[model samples]
Target: MKLIAKSMLVMGMVMSLTACKKESKLNPIPTSLISDASAYDSPDRIATLVNGLYATFKGSGFFGTQYIYYSEARSGDFISTNLNPTRGGLTYQMTVDPGISDVSAVWTQGYQIINACNVFISSMEEKGIKVLTPQIANNYLAEARFLRGLSYYYLLQLYAEPFTKNNGQGKGLPLRLTPNKGLAEYNLARSSVAEVYKQIITDLDYAEANLPANYSSAALNTTRAHVNTVISAKTNVYLSMGDYANVIKEADKIVPATAPFVAPTGVKNALQTEVTAIFKAPYTTTESVFSMPFSNTDVPGTSLANAYLPDGANATGLGSAGTGDFYLFEGGIVSDPLWKTTDKRRALVFTTIAGGNKGRQWSTKYATGSPYTDYVPVIRYAEVLLNLAEALANVNGVDSRSLALLNAVRQRADQTTTLTASSQPELISKIIHERHIEFLGEGIRNADLMRLKLSVPAKTPLGSSPVPQINPENPNYLWPIPNTESLYNKDI
Candidate 1:
């Protein structure tokens, strides 16, 4: 996990905001600063602070890299050839111990981003900013709040029980809403899951009302917290909360059914065609709703492809399976009849001996650049469609609408073989299947198991199955809160 080492004082004292990689090349996080009075003296300085928020997102701890690695390793999507994913090796399968470096990094880095967001949010509220930069400050405040709420949303999923489990009354991360003014604020206690969700919803609600609806720049629209990002984030939060109604409500903004799906800001948020093309390389499509940007000069320490591909000396891919660390369970979607023939998705996986791993199957999604520059997709338009489909299936059972949505995704990879299911349960099953294939190796698998209350099927990294069953209720399923917070925060 990566953390920007900027304090609130650093935020205000900044003279220039480093331009992001969206428009041009991305440079490393800039550490330039002056003093608060001079910083906020101009509206441009405050704008730079807002850019700093995305800078945090670019950190390796957040979307820059490890977060995706942690999520996928824990999830069933990819089994590791190495025993310990935390160490340079692969996962030991959700280590019972909380001291896993990667896990700890995730916690520490997550909080770092949270703290950064808090500082931005609280700093924007200063009365001086109201007089000098009300509009810019409000815009940035909403953006910061949206990003902060999204961070908490991710943390709650990994650290707390699913909201559906106990109506969200269970243990949640400690609420650190205000800026960390001093060491005294570090002692805060954990908030209830419902409380966290409420705060998340509150922040996002404001973001929806205030954040710019559209940006002409794809970099700003997809990489920054615009209306689409907020909508995507809200969909994820509600889905995790088991609030199907709201999931549909948020997803509806991006699903484009018969009409062109657009963000609440009136920006076109629909998926781009050519499923393989969308992910084969970086910045491939408009389908990417929200993603973290990385450039050659400022690449995250480890690219997402590191463990998945045994090539790219710059990649941290640990791929060592002759067949695949994750294999088709057999007689199912992985072995779909079309896979042997026309399925374009199947082509992305190929066998090769590289990086000391022989006959390992690797996904080409991250093979774009020598060092693997594929951007991390935090939210995709396809996920929105699937979320909406799942919500509708659960709400109205199997219907034409849900079927159409599910089929649309299914047909994306291979239009020749459109799929269908007989009931709501069947349709939901299809949606899950589609996600596994659609998001393979992207880090969505394990979390899906936890939220859907599904079991993790043990398997060799070679894609062989029938290892064992990890019940969804296992405590290991929920990552432990890092000692960084628990040990320091007495309330935790």
Candidate 2:
């Protein structure tokens, strides 16, 4: 059933991509057209659709690859050295134009998943599958809702201005709660960030309330949405919303009283003692909250190795991340830090200059084994701890608990030293620094700056010092609504 469902999901999304075409000569009908009755009336198909939704989430267009890479590159974590600059979002080469392919792919692919969730949710509620128990059905609904909320979160971050930037009134994604139905459904205008966030909170709130504590099946465990999974996502949402108190409230649900802090959902997550092992395969670190895994057989088409590591860079024969475009800094905090040169986090990526390239220090985090398999970590427990510490500092002006959380993450990276912050602002600064170093290649830098309303201090391969900052007031900070969307949606 899993295999068949996985295959169908790939086909399902492929068709969705085809449907996104602006113009075509042929009038090809969809290959599989199961009506609401055919899909939802059966318990088996309903179960399969739930898994299929995950397949959509796992797609390269989403979390499987592009989402992570684009976020990292655009956030100024790495400078693009490639001549053409393929991934425009990473280097700020693309314009705030409606027709840009890179930005359009993100919009189209995100809505594909969003619409898939809408279909599953509507069918389950309207048609009713008799074979499953009530608890099972509710869990499925919770999972669908979580994914919907998650999809919107990513879209908003990329396409809309930061919620905190203009008091949440910026043009946001079209808040489509129902299953898509042809051009009519597609032709809608943007919602305000505040409005979209309200919907996201509503969906996630239900997910947190009804989702199970955990699942026994390894496949069904952390990969699926449980209460803690929902909480982890909600913490992220609140953090993005700049609701620091709510961020603390949501994070507290997962954070532990001490080290080896296992979540209430039975996820035994903590700051990994060894920094390098965090990105390795089978990805069950003491710190992973939610991760999307891919093996050799079922790969995220844009594998991180292929996107970050250059050719001949990996002697492991696994894969490459890009054509040597992704370059890191030797003098920056990423490699040789101004504060702590002995930090294990810096040492991990700089090991062998990230598989030995001539003019660049790259990342080896994704270049795992032969055949190059690794997982995309959607959220980590370490981030939650950092969020908690930052929130505490923001709320109470740097207390013992906040400082301890900061020290815990930093010390976990390098046990020989502990960090100190005399004031709330100092502690918040330390917490942000910890996040940057801790999640170096993991792609949180862009979002961190967005929520803080700070200008992106960008650099280029050709230039020496930083480029003019991409400011908070600029439209380039957010991607434009696609030409496809504007062509169809009159309100756009």
lDDT scores of the candidates, listed in order: 0.65, 0.70
Query: What TM-scores do the predictions have?
Result: 0.84, 0.88
Residue-by-residue lDDT tens digits, candidate 2, 401-475: 888888888787777777787888888888888888888777688888888998776554444444446888777
Model 1 lDDT per residue over 1-492, tens place: 001112121211213322233411221122122225455455556666666666666567767677776676665545455454443233436554566666666676677667767766665565426644455556677878888888888777678887888888988888777755444567777889999999999999988877766665666566766677788888878888889999988887666655344343456776666777666445736788887766665566666655565444312443322212332223333545535456677766655435654444556566554455667788888888888888888999977787787777777777887778788888888887788788876767766776777766664444332234567677666777765555556677
Q: Candidate 1 — which residues are off by over 4 angstroms? A: 1-37, 85-92, 131-133, 257-265, 280-284, 312-341, 353-359, 461-468
Worst 10 residues of 1 by lDDT: 1-10
Specify the poorest-scoring 10-residue window by lDDT in model 2: 24-33
Identify the candidate with maximal lDDT.
2
**TM-score winner among the candidates?**
2
Residue 324, model 2: Cα distance from true site in angstroms: 2.1
lDDT of candidate 1 at residue 353, scale 0 to 100: 37
